[model samples]
Target: MHWHDEIETELQQMKRELKRSTNWNLDHSSDPNIEGLENVLKKLNHLTGLQGVKNEVNTLINFLKIQQLRQKKGLNVMSLTLHSVFCGSPGTGKTTVARMMGEIYRELGILSKGHLVETDRSGLVAGYLGQTAIKVDRLVESALDGVLFIDEAYALAPEGSGNDFGQEAIDTLLKRMEDYRDRLVVIVAGYSNEMSRFINTNPGLQSRFNKYFYFEDYQPEELVSIFEGICQQNDFKLLKESRKHLLAKFSELYIHRDDKFGNGRLVRNIFDQVIEKQANRLVKLPRVDRDKMMVILAEDIPD
Candidate 1:
């Protein structure tokens, strides 16, 4: 056989081996569960903010559903690459959304396991030579049939660092991504600018991750709503004055936001502080009533 024919035969064999190992049966038809899909959609919609992200995810779900329909019809279907880049700042719900996406994809029969394995630079890269690849490979193995979420992925390639082993981890990751392209999805998330630079570091990275989700900072109203949700979840209620004060505080925080400003995280912190203060105040009460025990007063708001 010619060299081209030999290569083709090897490729076909590899494909068959991969199919058997993954137990992927393209002919097997599993009816789409509408209730499951709706539950996933409802979860996505219930998130505090990220209207744009919600819309993008809806579009992706629709596309995947169409692809499934095409496969049932025995029509030619193009491969769908679910790997993505999430660009946002701290506390922007990147990780939260990645987890949601994993469940959504799994429900759509795209991934066998919808679990998310979250890591960062320190998790993948090793201190010594030749170890980074091994470390990354282990992570990839664990993340198979699931999603590998690399937070602050830009740190993998530090700028102007000549001796960093991050490149080795990246190389290992890229290879495994190709080997398990059908069963695994990798999401790299970081600050918008830094993530862009990280992607530009490797030419192949851009092509592999065609979908980009940019999570915008939460607005003041959304932040307030998040705080309210937290309060309700924890069996706490904000007094009318406390609610007004919190709204103002959130607005002020949003207006004077810095690069490190935590969106949902900020609200959570404030909520915790208020709860602590409320407890402190309750301890001083001669006789704490049920309503007073659950109510957060304006004085509980931290300065």
Candidate 2:
């Protein structure tokens, strides 16, 4: 069973603590940020499907707890922080979970302002000379008091392209992370092998992000659950027959994917296609049978 399935009690404990601390009902608010963070963590746990990865994240939550107490004491000490590197394959739910972590850090007061700014080589680095550094500087200023997540970070420094200005952007970003150490969190993500090489390229990037989180692929059962959940989310019902068919398809896809499945992203892509087929089938009927409209049949999803 997934550890996420057990987090409901922990969530309840947080709520109870919140109520006891403030008798004036201060916790009540239209806070999608809080809700979104929880959702993201839950999704992360689900996508990860690995015990080690989930355990590492538990440490992060503890860090937030300690930071919260330190702030409450009003000691004014600098908050200890880290720039983490998420090393894994694609579809490991890094982006979704990191986005939530941004909100969590904000909600817990680790950062006065918590926002997640995402970019890749193309977004932070430019095509022209001297422009990459300038753009990366602006990006840093924008994420001053928030979190900056750089996906596919290894691309910033590639082979034989020593003159590429992306390196300048990388250097500038590392320095700013230190300058605003108290206020910002930077997470660098990409494939495991490539990311290792990328980090080894610069000590500045290496020491800041001391922690590493590896996202492993999902098992067959987990992939089944993912597909079922996606179907239900899109208002498409997964019938028993269709469920079996999906399982079969997943087995075939899983083998071929090898490393391409990328955790459960392949499941999501398949989910998208199945839902689209379901929609197309319903579009032809004028008078919709509410009962049948959302049902997904084995025939609806072609191999």
Candidate 3:
């Protein structure tokens, strides 16, 4: 056979073997905590922004569901590598989604423990040569049967820093990833450009992380909705004019955003500042009514 034909034949054989290996009974009711998976999906649906992120997650969920269904039918199941690369800016909900994915995977019988262990360069890298490997290994151990979310993961590779121990941590993590492939999932998150560079830094990284999800920055309206949700959750109310003022402020923030522009985080900071200003405004009052105490006025918005 020609080279292309040979490759196709091999792939067909592999599929046949997978089908045979995963043959089993198709009773999903026996699975434990199935409702947990549904709840995770529901939460993903409820998230205000991240339409792209939501679609990607739902696709993965559907794939896993199919895999489980195949297993139930006593057919061979294909092993899935759940390791992923999350490319986005700060406050883009990468960490939040990672945590939820852990739970979803656990409920799907993909992980034994669905907890999330969040870390960064400081959590994995060390000052010395050998110590870096040890630190990374320990973190991988703790993250077993769960998800290990490494934020700002590109920082693990500092360009032109020959003596940097970050490379050592990456090496250790790669080994552990393979050793515990069935029980652990590692999610590396960073800015899109930086994360692309980081992935290209190691050939192994590209091969190991097959899934990439990009989180787009929240739009002005979504940011406003987020702020409103925060207010409702905290029992705070925005006056009619204050609501209009806040929307305009968010629109301005979105338009003039720089690399450091934090979408959700910026809204949160504004909310906090508004609360502080409201407190300062109310302190001078001889007596305050409940309505006044909970209401946020237009003047409370930061300039």
Candidate 4:
């Protein structure tokens, strides 16, 4: 069994034992949800690379908890703006982190529902004037009481375009943000430079999005770790030589990476390709054992 599956089984057993114990009479109705929240944190922490991102999230959670305590004690509490900017390249865990933030917010009683609504330029912008506002409104309405994660948000404000509907979408989105300030959180993400420019496009965006989390690209070793974790989760084991090949492959990929590098997505794609190769090799074999089926050899590694 997987490590996580074993942990989950143990957790369930403990919960059952606690329920049966009369000495532990504390209310346990919310224990499952609390466990779920902790699980989310565990998953966040276990993500490969992004140490800086993890630290930022922890600091933000701590600050919010302290602010809540102050508010409960009738002390002056500073205004909180949960909306944020996530600047990162593709597949750097921006969307994944956004989804987790929603769950965290819901658990902390900051949002009515912990859900994520993801969109891009095409989801918000319309071809005609006045229609963009309507589209944005519907999207925002669906995202109310949750998080609206806008990927490639910079496209909402194209440069040197005086007659585009992108600006209209942005304006409408900003207005809705104001209207639902207490109920909605907006997270805009894109390439670091482009996201900075997008936030600068409007003063409101500048004021509202004070928190910024920058996700750095995964290092070569981190990429290998991620790939290995994927394999382990899928019940695949790598041969001794396959590990070396993966390390070298990831190192080369990191060295030649451009802005278009897909990071974790690239690793996943490679895994898919390698598994296909494994399948082909297994089918051609006259006889194959369970070990052979589960093991990925160096020969299966893509060139």
lDDT of 3 by residue, 41-136 (tens): 899888889999899898988877787776678775665668899998898888899999898878877677879999999999988769988899
State candidate 3's TM-score.
0.88
**lDDT tens readout by residue for model 4, 1-303:** 999999999999997654433211111112225566688889899888899999999888777777666656767555557889999889899999999999888777777687999999999999887999999999999998899999999998888887789988988888898777667889999999999988998898898788899999999889888889999999999878999998999999899999999999999999999999999999999999988999999999999
For TM-score, the strongest prediction is 1
The 0-to-1 C-alpha lDDT of every candidate, in the order given, reads: 0.86, 0.74, 0.85, 0.86
Error of 3 at 35 (Å): 1.5
Report the C-alpha displacement of residue 143, candidate 1, in angstroms: 0.7
- Please write out the lDDT profile of model 1 over residues 239-294, one tens digit for every residue: 88988898899999999998788998888899888988888999998999988988
Q: Number of backbone collisions per candidate, in order?
A: 0, 1, 10, 0
Candidate 3 shows a clash count of 10
**TM-score rank order:** 1, 3, 4, 2
Error of 4 at 80 (Å): 2.3
Ranking by lDDT: 1, 4, 3, 2
- Tell me the TM-score of model 4: 0.87
lDDT of 2 by residue, 1-303 (tens): 568866987888997654433311112212234565676567657653666777787677775555445545764323344578898888877887677677666665556567889989888988887888789888888887678899999999997786788788888887777566666789999988889999999888777667798877666677888777776676778899988898888777767775556556778777778877877888888877977887988977769
- Candidates in order, TM-scores: namely 0.90, 0.78, 0.88, 0.87
Positional deviation of residue 282's Cα in model 4 after best superposition, in angstroms:
1.8
